[model samples]
Target: MGALHVLSGGAARGLIARLREDFHQHTGRTIEARFGAVGLMRDRLLAGEACDVLILTQALIEELVVAGRVLPDSARALGLVRTGVAVKTGAPVPCLETPGAFKDALLAARAIYFADPAKTRAGTHLMQVFQRLGLMPELAPKLRFFNNGSAALQALSEAQEAEAQGVLVCTHMTEILATPGLQCAGVLPKSFELATIYTAAITARSEQPQAARALIEMLAAPEAVADRRADGFE
Candidate 1:
């Protein structure tokens, strides 16, 4: 069992702990994982960062493959995860059934927060949601972007202190809501829900190619899927 360095997207946030345990148990390897937004991780890899494996959206992984960063035929789909929405614990749940209702919820929100779109696909889609609902101009002034989950959670926590409402992020990081102080608001209705599929691949220059492949297989095993769903992905 050797050290396997991994560069991955934020979508895998909820299931990391389980994945680490399973991979270590299976191959006796310790995965050194670096999770960031897909775009940022892709930039770092393109800039020559060394990593044994890469786990990210299939679209991004295929882009890397096309650019000759990842080996052809190495990309393997893990599963799909849909973006989600939640409110901090104790907050009143809002009606998000229709597009108009969702827009109203946004306009009524005091301070809306989400990950930086340039760095995250979820945030990018959320931006599109705003545009589709024709609420961009009105909501733009109040929108706040975070670097990562911790930043978003911090904003959600602090909003209550100032007696202002905060719009929690909708992404695979939905597990963060179970962290004691946050509550479950509701996910976007089916009409607006976006599902993102994840894929894992060995980098073209990976030193631990075999180990990387083994880890990817372990992550896509049956048990891993259950763990993933428990973490708020589906």
Candidate 2:
């Protein structure tokens, strides 16, 4: 196998690391990945970056197919992701089990953070979530958009130190829960939850098309599900 280059978004971050390890161990092929925000990855691919595989949202996969950048038949559903909220570690996790409780938490927080929709799908849906919950007007002014949740987590820690209620990010950032300064507050209530389906496809111009296809298949296989689950991916 030649270089199997992958272009992927942050949603697949932790999972990609695990997959790459498994792929190399099994096939002895180097898996090179470029991770970015979803929109950034999309734009880069549109600009003709030579990517063998793309792991992104279903909509993005469809877009690439329509643009003739990926074969329509090569698209495969990988997993589903839902928005989760977390606060800095040790900060009191206010109850966000209901719509009203969520609103109260948002209002009480001094600064809230989520990624930008221009870069991530979570940020896109988070805007709609605020609207759907009817708290957009009140919360919009306080919103501080981030490029990634890792940075938001840093800020959250600072806020906690200041005794200010911290931020909420729209990501399946469960891995961050183990960090010393953070913990999951709670996922938004079910009624307001927005789930995004993640998918993978082989790029049309990939020189290693077969290897790309094989990689996708392996990642979606039953054995891979255990690693996916371990990484907080559903």
Candidate 3:
């Protein structure tokens, strides 16, 4: 069988990778995934990138369906991801039990990293959280932006190893939790928490429609969701 191509966001990367092995084992099918920021993935699809499936936030999925870029009926919710704070292993975990504590923890960090707010939904909501906390002006100077959460975490890791400078990253709990040697400080406080529902759909240009639907169904299976929860999905 031809390999099914899937374009996905970073939040779903690990869970999908693990599940694909099981998928191929039992079904003798193959899946190839391209993962990155949701916005970047959407842009690639809009620019005519070819893939059998698209895995990303529900908002992006809706947008693509409206644009006729994905089959509306094929869309299914896979899981929900929450925003959280993370630090390199061995760093002191921050207290996030209260909104004031969350703001204080962020303010006290030596360097804070996240994806570009102008380009990623997670980053944009993070910016809104900062604004709500009245820390934007103070946090802006300490903020470092990257192409995606992975890059931001990479940068944070390097800074920690080389300079011992304390650093924190803000992104989906799933991505942070998946990164080796990174410890999730805590989810964003309830008042400011952001949960993004990730969904999967067959692309408009899918060459393997039946295979794509099968893979999407596999992703929504109870076993898949259990794996997702273990990876920090809500």
Best by TM-score: 3
What are the runs in model 3 whose C-alpha is more than 4 Å off? 158-164
TM-score of each: 0.86, 0.85, 0.93
**lDDT for residue 177 in candidate 1, whole number 0-100:** 41
Instruction: Please give the CA lDDT of all the candidate structures.
Output: 0.73, 0.75, 0.85
Candidate 3, pairs of clashing residues: none
In model 1, the clashing pairs are: 87-185, 88-183, 89-183
Ranked candidates, highest lDDT first: 3, 2, 1
Each prediction's number of clashing residue pairs: 3, 2, 0
lDDT (Cα, tens digit) per residue for candidate 2, span 38-113: 7788888889888999988899899889889898998988787666787766667889888899889888877788
Pairs in steric clash, model 2: 89-181, 89-182
What is candidate 1's lDDT per residue for 138-226, written digit by digit as tens?
98888788885546765676666345355654555444543446665667777787777888899998998988888777767676777
